[model samples]
Target: MATTTGTAAPELTGLPLLGSLLDLKNDSLGTFLRARRDHGDVVRISAGPPGLRATVYGVFSAEGAQQVLAGESANFRKDNAFYQEVRESFGNGLLTSQDEDYRRQRRLVQPLFTRRRVDGYAAAIATEVTTLAEEWRQADAGTVDVLQDMARLALRAVARILFGTDVDAAVEIVEKNFPDVGAYVLRRGYSPVNVPRDWPTPGNRRAAAVHRALYEVCDRIIAERRSSGAAPGDGQDLLSLLVEAESAEDGSFDATELREQVLVFLLAGHETTATSLGFALHLLALHPEERKRAHEEVDRVLAGRTPGAGDLDALPYVTRVLKEAMRLFPAAPVIGRRAVAATVVGGVAIPAGADVIVAPWVTHRHPDYWEDAERFDPDRFTPEAEAARPRYAWFPFGGGPRACIGQHFSMLESVIALAMLLQRYDLEAVDTVVPVASAITLQAAGPARCRLTPRNP
Candidate 1:
């Protein structure tokens, strides 16, 4: 069902000065839910003072999602204010670029994530996960912070996949400051007022410093790659692939292009996988029955051998578990786009300049599409059950042309990582209740601690 096409849209009312901005910022999921319940799917949330313009329409229906993300995607370009603000840090990276430049960049980088190329990365991913598991065993600790440990593993895995053997130095720089760098950028991007970096405010100063640190990491990586003068397409790593790639016009990606793309991949790729895996492990830990099933499936399929690219399809249960985890806690919870031209969605007439928000967190849990939506049930992702629902109902990686390029890599890496970990150890959540916090990516609000009991061979 397409959104009712009309001019009237219910506006979410608020106090005189603030509107719903503060609530939206503080508790985005809660705020969106309240608006959807009270108002219709197309609810207007207004913010800012009398003169300044700050208004965003929350589109919570699958129809609206298709309209903005797929059907009428061209009318909703990535030149939105949010992406503009994000571009300050991301530069003209694929995540931030629009139109021709975005398309060309996508073309050049698309081959790197192809099935063949990503399959080549399986051994390195397995190696990283295996090494992390061994270190945990050696520690012999009672409890480990799953979120913290997963973060480190994700960073190291991505570092090796992107840089191969020359990852030690770059990984250190990224690991140390990645959190602060992400927090600073997100904080400023969501702030109502745009504070200039040169203003020297505490937040501004912090963002500037973190920005420099992140750029330094990217710069150093690019510089090292360039100095090596390795033949394009000489190696299997992503950097090598990018160096070897030629544009439609037969031009190579320059230094700035390389840096921006690498930065986006580093930021978007690892965090999403790490957060989703943490949630999956946390959920599995809480459900012994499900964990047992997973273990049984792994044992039947791999027979205690390390998981590899070929084993991914054979481990259906592991894939289902990951899908369910993402359904409940999508890493990119909200997808926003600015209407470049006048459009009507779900019966509401949207003006040319309106900011439209499509939230997976909301739509994925909608009662119409999902049964027992809040429950952690991997069975919901079984082929039969998934085929029964709308295609857009469970899109954790988004849809259409601009959907996540590395989704396949993320999924494969996750399956391998989880299978290897579960094969060697049984994990239980230490924290009875883990809280969720949304930064650039959705993550555990506090430490999600887990106790690992090593399995005897």
Candidate 2:
């Protein structure tokens, strides 16, 4: 065990009463980056007025991230306000569940995400990609918003895979209502003070209404699945698998639990993967040399065939491109946790019950780990290079027991989609800078427009 220096970690200077709240709200990603740059890895960030003030210990180094997320994961818990906000809106699914509930959920859900099982969904993913490609091919305008299109594509693909026959209903509900829910979570998650959720304020009422609609759609589909008596062995969709998942110790998820898990899958599955795919294409479009390498790898490995699970390993360069994109723009830019007890991390003493965050957004760009950190270089992820870096240096899907369960599925979906898209279109970025905001997830706040020219044209 390492001893702390017995000194306070550096703190970012802020307003007299509000601390870092305004800066954080206005530009969270930039604020975090500035924190790391100005105050090293362990920086104390206080927010809100003194009465309701929240102070977070920002751990912004790969080693610090490893300590918080993986090494001493038990010491850092998801009991913070941000997670509570997410849980209230999204339900106590795997993402926000704790202790035994998390363990049980993990055991039941783990087998469903096994490499072989996740790989089996490649055809469904390819179908969505093909649909998008055809739409782009027929469009009179050469440009499209990659961020928006990829979100729609990923939602459709995951919805189809999860709900199967009921995909149309699930997609319609999510497409119409999820943005408001996400916005609500982000706004409340960060604000130090909030109006009571039951007060029927405009935001509260809208959020409540959307939550009910989301739950109702999911409950109806789950009910239909139950009525259909779909066993996991015979059924191909995720909902069926969840319906059938059972154990002697934990039995199975009940109706509400099932809805919660479905909601988690719908939110995490599409959003993170969509972020990866959108940014991967955007990065490639901006860097011609990297794009050329990706194109060559896709063409050579795929050879005029639609990308599938088997092609994942063959397209090494394409994988690296995706990895590099993730490094630059991790889907979950900042992850929040609360220290269960006093702990020493990166030679800084974090007091018990302190709100802590390990920022992949900063760690992925840590000066010690990444040379030319701002550059979009796929070669940074080559096998040798990856081995030389810390494990948490590129944690886009997070780390530890609480890590995102859909990681394999996200990668598989991204690789197949990127390969297929690269094979069909030559891309050029219409917007040079894709302004992003750290929302519930890392979101492209502005348009990520890209011009596509059919390769054969």
Candidate 3:
């Protein structure tokens, strides 16, 4: 059913069954690598559609991804089946919304991620990471799952920067309904039809309940902040900004809309940061020279003091290593887009309603684009070397009009956090590490256990 960019449909082999099994096995990246090796840049597979089938292709090529994300952006929409799967968990959130709604919502929220705003958030990020690191220092040292710790860290930063100082309690609120929200997607077996919460299975029931909890907590924060009459754009935290950030055209978000915005921040923000941070640490630990360089950069730039906003941009080597780490193991490893209208991209005809997956994991490692593509080499991103490479070859945060809105904030936050940890601690995988891929993000299967010894006196 699937056809190449050229008019000729690929000769049907056993791929329909083979591809289906590989995908159902949930090793999507592995499947992509196989196809890229078997076919060229463009590979077509039967996805059970009648006329049009999904295309598994590369986006790591700087020119190729740019064309899809920027040049021909109008042809794409975020409303793909993959995103639709999580519709209940994130209804109209920025990551999945389409067209006019997406634009309006994005415009309303853009101010939160501006350089000035994110720069101000430096102290908050530094303080949070320091507190967490201090607590870790006080604990018995052996192995720690940096994933959970990083998740908590990113969430707390969100609390201070987005929800104000009150984000700690909301974690439980999200946990309550997060289960059923997944049944809408992650159920061992699930039905799409909406059954009443009470009548729904336990997972669905929990999903509905947790969803309410999320809304209520958001509602409370919005109500409290609005009632306080805080100064407009004070940048106290995210909740206040949502209450105050007025678009030049629409004025400001309604209370109902603000709730959706909070949910958007919660869903879009945390996991990606956490996953990247963990993988960065994993890479540094596995590649000790890079870890030492990152540490030395932090030490040279900030001395022994905690890193602040000013220190981030100056920590060039640290950022490069982190960039390489992300390039090797991008947090949002795979991103999919569907064509809402027929379009031509990479000189290939993309028909309307076909799924387009541009995987950073596969593309970032494409042999043609990178030297020693599989090895960990942070120096490859050095300024001179970067200039030599094509532009879209390494997009950890993606690019173009619909690119990640929080790109700056996330980078600032990530750099600061990594500096804090590297200054004092060394971490690694205790045993062989196996990465597990899921509907949204990539996670290491076991505890990233490692001996965390204090730097020599």
- Highest TM-score model number: 2
User: Which ten-residue region of model 1 has the weakest summed lDDT?
Assistant: 1-10
**Which model, 1 or 2, shows the larger lDDT?**
2
lDDT of 3 by residue, 1-457 (tens): 2233544323213344343444635666776666666665655554433343434434435666777777777766665656776554666667777788788888888877788877998898888898888777765655666767887788778767877677677776664555346545543212223445456687666666677787888889788888886677664887787788786685788888777778867766777787778777777777777777887888888888878788877999888877887887787777777777765555555667877767788788888888788788988888898898877788777778888888888888889999888887876656447466645666566666455766632
Question: What is the per-residue lDDT of model 2 for residues 269-361, given as tens digits with 9 covering 90 to 100?
Answer: 999999999999998889999999888888887789888899888888998999999999999999999998888887889998999998889
Ranking by lDDT: 2, 1, 3
- Candidate closer to the true structure by lDDT (higher is better), 2 or 3: 2
Task: Give the Cα-based TM-score of candidate 3 against the true structure.
Answer: 0.89
TM-score for model 1?
0.95
lDDT for residue 409 in candidate 3, whole number 0-100? 81
Query: Which regions of candidate 1 fall more than 4 Å away from where they truly are?
Result: 1-7, 248-250
lDDT at position 358, candidate 2 = 88
In candidate 2, position 451 carries an lDDT of: 90
What are the Cα lDDT values of the candidates?
A: 0.84, 0.90, 0.71
Query: Model 3's lDDT to the true fold?
Result: 0.71
